[model samples]
Structure formats: C-alpha cells, structure tokens
Target: MKEHKTTPTQEKVLEGMDKVYENLIEFKKKANSDLVVMENGKIIRIKPSTL
Candidate 1:
C-alpha cells in the first residue's frame, strides 16, 4: 500500500470540498430535490432521501 501526501493548502481545499458536498446534500433534502450525477457514463437523478 502507498501513502499519499498533501500540502497544507491542498488539505484545506479538500476539507472545503467535503463541507460543500455535505451542504449540497442538506440543501437537496430540505428542498425536496433530486441530485443529478453521472454513473457508468450515464446521467442519473437520485432523490435526496435515498442518501
């Protein structure tokens, strides 16, 4: 197994991305909206409740 190293700035960016993702999920749930994403080269819509 190999270990990956990230710079401090990279770590902060990754953390920010995670927070944004969490907020997006929360927004979707509250808005009763579907999350659109790509899977196996296909576009799909998933209900937030499914999460």
Candidate 2:
C-alpha cells in the first residue's frame, strides 16, 4: 500500500468528524437518551422500540 498524506480538504474533513463526535455527545446529554437513530448522516428516527 502507498502512504498518503492528508491535504487541506482531508484535514477539514477530519475536523468535521471531530465536530460530529462532539455534537453526538451533546445530543446524548440534552436528549437524556442514547436511542439515536440515523440514516446517511441525518436523524431519521428516534426513540424507536418497535422495528
């Protein structure tokens, strides 16, 4: 495999990932729940018990 370096865009993407993780923590705190449901990076369902 070839070694690759992150470009500016790749670095930005990494930053976005960090933000997403942080936001997920916030979501869990404010919702007081861990029943997060997502599809394609967007919330499609929440508090789902019947599936």
- Which candidate has the highest TM-score of all? 1
lDDT (10s digit) by residue, model 2, range 1-51 = 999999999999999999998887677667666555678989765542322
Native-vs-model 2 lDDT? 0.73
Highest-scoring model, lDDT: 1
Candidate 2, TM-score vs. the true structure? 0.57
TM-score of each: 0.88, 0.57
What tens-digit string does per-residue lDDT give for candidate 1 at 1-51? 999999999999999999999999999999999999999999999998897
* Candidate 1 structure lDDT: 0.96
